[model samples]
Target: MLKGLAGLKAAAAKPNSFARHGVATVLVTAATMALGLLTGILVARSIGPEGRGALTSVLTTVQMLGWLFAMGCGKAVTYTLSRDHSAGGRLLSTWTLILLPLAGLAIGTGYLLLPLLLAAQPPETLELARLYLPMIAMALLSELMLGLILGDQDFRSFNALNFLQPAGVAVVYVALWAAGRFTVEAAVIVQAAMSTLVLAAATALLIRRHGLARPDPALGRKSLWYALRTHGDVVGGVITQRLDLLIIPAVLSAKQVGLYALATSLSWLIVSLSSALATVVMPAATRRGRSGRELVLNSLQATFAIGGLLGGGLFVFADIAISLVYGPSFADSALPLRLLLPGAVLYAAAAILLNGLYAENRPFTATLANLLGMAVTLGGLILFLNSGGILAAAIVSTVAYTLVFAAAATLYRHATGLPWRVFLPDPALLAALPRRLLTKPSPVAAAPANPAGK
Candidate 1:
């Protein structure tokens, strides 16, 4: 009977624990989305289109550079730490050592490229990028540390850290706006300051909870090789994701960039859901040896259902939502938002499939799909540049995402032999959500095998 109780406890903990984490991730992501929208509204309304565009460009540049410089160390750290608990300290130390030099290289490159890249922008925008570019190095360290937390599968802390910085920035931005001090520089500075605070807090917690070790060259090489294999895909993915935005300043006006950025920002809510699901999927897949078809299918159904509803809503209410949130000046952003909703959902699906590939230890395969997607994006952008403005950018983005999803899904099939039908949604999976919440675990039916009850 005691064994029965233990069995029940374990089963209850197993699925229920994952369910709880999924629920928390969804809730946190929803809250973060709301907070993010609020921040966008506040910033956009205060700065107008040109200023908002400048701020948006700076932030995007910082993030893209940070991820590029991170060189997949963060992901490598997570993958390594998830599989080998004993090597946590060495993994963290090695990745940190590797990231530092890369960070310097990244920052230097950004400095060299800034003049050429931002020369098209207004002087104010260029100045902001110059001032804030240094922060990406720090952001890289923060991201690596966050990756460590994720490796530990401490979703609670991960969710907290994810929300805290945005929440802080929102609050601080509101205060600054109320005081009539919310210039582009002020907004960017506030974001950087809040992020730094979060980073410091995260670093302290990581050290206290998961202490550090000295760098080991051999371990560093192993992690570096792993990061190299994985981060190529990461770099390609990031480029495809942000290439449109990067090109906007060159071919379009700051106001047009602002409108497009606003739409894209709002559309990322769909992407966020995919990312949240993937957070659970990756570590869970690692444990299961492979991301089985049923598992991936179930995740796909959930993503599609959630994404469909959100994307549908955004499409129908694009005008009203944009007007109400960002004011009438951003009314032009509505069509682009509508255009991006479907693509964002596709992007989300691709992300989950891509994560499945990672869990299967086939990072290089994922790289090919991502590079193909980036190439498509670039080609589409060039093709559409002269004729179409923000609208063209939006449509091309959707096309790029569709092709990327097809590429990733095909590779996933080759890797796992999963059928295409699994990607479709089912009412049964949707119904499972409530059932999981209401049902109680059954007791064990039999005892473990033992000879003579020994």
Candidate 2:
């Protein structure tokens, strides 16, 4: 047992920067997920199916709007900063200033439409929506701050905030529930408060650590144009990725929506692992410049291996896992979970490629691919849902993600004219794995060699 334990640690300690970052990200994500699972259980027990479903709907709406307000600036920031530290810092400040009003506008619009939107819902759901919509504005503000931190590769801070935001909201919700102030409206209000507080703290820390210098007007204008173009692609990608949730609710019952939400939350375990790897790889790939092909290949190989392993494990244990995390009430989620497993794998592959595209500053292609996938998904859903229901939705999502991955792979190949197979791991590469092998150190390394490197 000790030998096995030691071997596991040794494997974990292997000289791979990506592995180290993946490990960190996994730890953080796992912590956050654990907290989320606990919170879900608590909310489920306290709020029952209807309340949880309403909360899910409200949260989803907030997320979609939040993405619009932030406009992919977080990723843009990460890609930019990874290349030019000074410009990145300046851009971060400028983005924050510009996005604040947009956040306010999004929230204002939600507030104004809340009454009409709720009037169209059941009385219970309407009340929840009314309470929930207003708080989303605060969450939007935090998202903008998140973009700043991500651009700077401040994962430690970013992860800290990520963990704190959800965990803190859970704690507040539990406290309120215990004190008999646990209305869904109150929960949303508390969530907004926690989100705003965390964003303020994170932004303050970023300014202090990175300085508050604003971008020059000319540089800011250039960066804005770059951001606008890149962000459009990101928005399209997000829509492609998240469109199912929007469509599922409209075409299916609330129960079906709840079931789908449960499956998606479970699938997030796999996607989160993939996202963690992409998060670490994106900055490194950006730093590699024109010579990023090797880095991109290695990153994809590692991501596929890790993501495949994690996703497969989830697939194997789908039933028991879903039962435990979400309760037997969500047993219907298991089939969808199993069906979505392969899609999760493809999603990870697409993510790695997307990062490479971002690093290459060819976000336009990535965006175009995403738009194509979105069209495919929407068309598939429209056709399939009429005949097949929720199952159709799952199939459409899987097919759409597969299309996105293939498109991204093709684009990467054409842009760099590199052999596409190099990005894919050969069976021989996996089969001939040596117990002992010498590997070249990554040129960029993980951390800067000196404090002044950045």
Query: Model 2 Cα displacement at 352 (Å)?
Result: 1.0
lDDT (0-100) at residue 418 of candidate 1? 49
* TM-score of every candidate relative to the true structure: 0.91, 0.83
Q: In candidate 2, where is summed lDDT lowest over 10 consecutive residues?
A: 445-454
Error of 1 at 21 (Å): 0.5
Taking the tens digit of each residue's C-alpha lDDT, what string does model 2 give over 1-454?
5764563344334425444555677688878887777777777667765566666766777777677666666666676676677675577567767777787788877666555533323566655665665555565556656766766666678778878888898888788778877766776777778777897898788777678776567756765666676776677676777777766655566677777877777776777766565776567666544444455666566567767888888889888976776678778888887777788788777887877777767767667778878888879887888688767778888787788888888887666666545665745534432221113333322222121100
lDDT, candidate 1, 1-454, per-residue tens: 6764664444344665666787788889999998998889888889999888888778888888998878777777777777776677777677777778878888889888777666568877887898898888788889788878877888899999989999999999899889998899888888889889888888888877768888889877876777788888888888788988888876688898899999999888889965577776666555444213344445666777788888998899999988898999899999988888888898888888887777777778878888987888889889996689999988988888878888988987777654555556667657786235313311112312212100
Q: lDDT values of the candidates?
A: 0.78, 0.68
How well does candidate 2 match the true structure in TM-score terms? 0.83
Q: How far is candidate 1 from the true structure (C-alpha RMSD, Å)?
A: 5.9
Locate the minimum summed-lDDT window of 10 residues in model 1. Answer: 445-454
TM-score of 1: 0.91
CA error at residue 132 for candidate 2, angstroms: 3.5
**Model 1 lDDT, full chain set:** 0.78
lDDT of 2: 0.68
